[model samples]
Each structure stands twice: as C-alpha cells, then as structure tokens.
Target: GYILSYNGGNIVNAKTGEKLFAQFLPDEVIPILYRYAKEKNHALLGYAGNEIITEMPDDQYVKEESRINKMNIRKVENLFEALEPHPTKLLMTGDPADMLKAENELSEILGDRMDIFRSAPFFLELVPKGIDKAKSLLRLLSKINLTPADMIAFGDGYNDLSMLKLAGMGVAMQNAAPEVRAEADYITLSNEEDGIAAALEHFCKRIFKSKRLKFRMWFKYGLKAQKLLAQGI
Candidate 1:
C-alpha cells in the first residue's frame, strides 16, 4: 500500500538506515513543526496550522492556467484519457459546501478514472490559501485538455480532503479523519491491508501480476549461479 518514489531512498542515512529528512509538507512549515514536535516528544509530529485550504480549483471560471509560460503544466484531466465523465454534465444547485458535495457525487457516476496521491497531514497544511490539489490537478488538466470531471483521488488525511473532494471519484480510506470522510464519495479498505492496490484493481480495471511472478522468472537463473559457485567454474 506504500507508494515509493525515486526520491524516497535518496534521503536515508547510510549507516543507521534512519531517515534524515523524510516527511511530506512544504519546506517552510517543516522546520517549525519539527522543532515543536521535538520539544513535545510527540510520535505524530506535524504542523497544525491556522489556515488550511480544502477547496477545489476555480478552473471553470479561469481560462489561463498559469502566467509563467516556461512551466509545463497540464490539468489532471488532460494527462490521462478515460478520466472524464460522459456527456460532461454541468449542474448548478446550492451554497459553496453543498455545491462541492454535489460535484463530487456527480463525478463518481459520470467519470471512470481515479488516481491516488498519498501524503501526510503536514503536506495538506502546506497548501497555501486558495490553492489546493484540485487546482494543481486542474493545471495538469488544462495542459492536457481534460476536465475536473475526469479524475479521481483517494486519501485518508486532512491533506487528502481537498484532493478527494476535487477528484472525480474521491474515496476515503476506512481509517480517515471524520472531516476527511465527510468529504469523500466512497469509503474503501484500510491503508494497512493493501487498500490502494485493491481499489486500483477494482475501479481502474487493471490486470495485476502477482509479486511471485518476478521470483519465478529469476529463480532458475539464481539456481544456476549457485551451482556455478559450488563448482568454482
């Protein structure tokens, strides 16, 4: 269920295998949280901030994604096909919060794609006011020629709330914050039980090969190496 990236292994301490700087969240907020959590000796250390933006991007209203032409940005919708809803239903109903909930539900039935971006609570707090995963994803969508109705995201923490709500099929893990769960359209398996893999298999319609497939492929070669070592050939 863990999502490993190339940078993950780069930060580990050589001799001790201890992580030197391994938590999520933006660079600015991390030091403050670290200092506070260090003094308190808290196991779950992070920045619980005053302002957290949990809203989706205002892509529909804005035409241009970014003023900086140098950056290559695309809306999440455009990067991958099979992400947007059919017929592209644009419904208008109520207040700010209610409208978002309606949008989340609408996306689930209409769109058929979901992608997971797992991050810690601190990362969510790092989002500047008025900026969110939806906005970032929208940037991706704009670049790729897709809409917000095409993508889905799964999460279980505060950071995941905006992303989940904005995603076409925002799913909350069973072990998510109450606030976060409230924003989700569906609830899936717990993080500890290969939940991400299960969700991807079922919803994404992906064909998964067993982990043992690699072992089976290489076992004969490994045995040959062992035999050669024994013969000193």
Candidate 2:
C-alpha cells in the first residue's frame, strides 16, 4: 500500500515508510509565496518534507487547523527563510473572501510555474505544475504493473476531479460538489451514510451477477482498487 500526501506532491510506502516519489516547489517560487502571504496578511502553511512550517503560529485559524488536523505546528518567524529551497506544497487559509482574492491574484502572479486552486472554501493550495492525485497515482500504478482501468476511485472535492475521471469506475458521494457528481460514473450515498461501503457493495454484487468474467476473475484473485477520500484541506 502507498499514501499520496499533499495532493500527490509526495508518495510513500504506507507500510515501510519508503518514499516512492516526491515533487517539491521550485526554489524560486518559495520566495514569491512568502512575499504574497506577508503582503496580504494571509496565513500560510508550508509542507516541507514531513514538517509543517508556518509564520502565523498564534493566528486563530492556523491554531484551529492544527488542532483539527493534529499537525505538529512549527512556527517560524520567516517561512521563506525556514523552508528555503525545498518545500513540497503550500496552503493558505483565511476568510473565504480573502481566499478568493488570493486565488485570483496568485493565479496571475505565479502564472504557469505552479498550480493554484481552492481545495476548500477558505483554503487555497499551491503545488508544482503537473503534480496531482491522478498523475501520481498513474506513476504508482505503472511501477506496480497496473493501469487506471483496474482501479476504482471515489472523490468529492474539486481537486479530486481528475482522479475521478481517470479511474475506470468513478464514484461520487451524494454530498459531493455538483461538478464532482456530474463527472462521476456513479453516485452513491453521502459519506455520513457510509457511501463508500454502499458503492463497493453495489459494484461487488453487480460484478457477481454480470457476465463480465474478466472483472469477476480479477476480483476473485485480488482487485487492485484505489480509494481516494479528498479531505480538501
């Protein structure tokens, strides 16, 4: 098993702690992000390797986020200096209104060097271009001798859009964003109602009843299924 963290900026072996892949922000972009955060008074969090670095340690929003995510908060006086040359991802959180503004401005400021998007209403994420869940999953699948067609993906967030589309079976929860549901192959119950379990059961039953012997055989052997629950953090 493997874990794709920071929206696939980093992939690691779930059992052995071995790094399968990692993509960090370019050295040039770190200063840009830091300058933007400082000038805008936005709370910024940097994911550098395994550490979470931030400048606003006492900011209420940052404190709440750390508590909720159980993140070890490393408060730095200067994030750009702390992270320097190798930060994997950056997350900016604040009022949704401010986030929207930041998203728009950063999109133009960073241009094509990075991908900037709102993972949540109040949270904006920045990662290197070409790094996303689907792309990293493809890399992992190739190493394991499997294809996207062999996988089942589930998601509900905007960031999950690509992964949902790339999988052979894309299941969206009832509570998913409208865009997500529209792109899914099937819609299941909401997460609170055990949506993932419901979708798996329905597919398993259908596979058993249908004439698709290939899928049945694969299931009987060992289905190479991939499940992604986007936290939208």
Predictions: Cα RMSD each? 19.5, 11.7
Expressed as tens digits, the lDDT of each residue in 8-71 for candidate 1 is 2113444575543232323343344334323432221111111111112233211111221122
TM-score of 1: 0.37
| Candidate closest to the true structure, highest TM-score | 2
Best by lDDT: 2
Residue 143, model 2: lDDT of 92
CA error at residue 2 for candidate 1, angstroms: 18
Q: Write one digit per residue (lDDT tens) for candidate 2, span 1-233.
A: 88888888988999999999998887788778878888899999875544567988877777766774678788887787777467678888889899999999999988689889976677788898888899999999999999999999988778889999999999998988899999999999997799999999999999777757776777765433322224332
Q: Which stretches of candidate 1 lie over 4 Å from their true place?
A: 1-127, 204-233
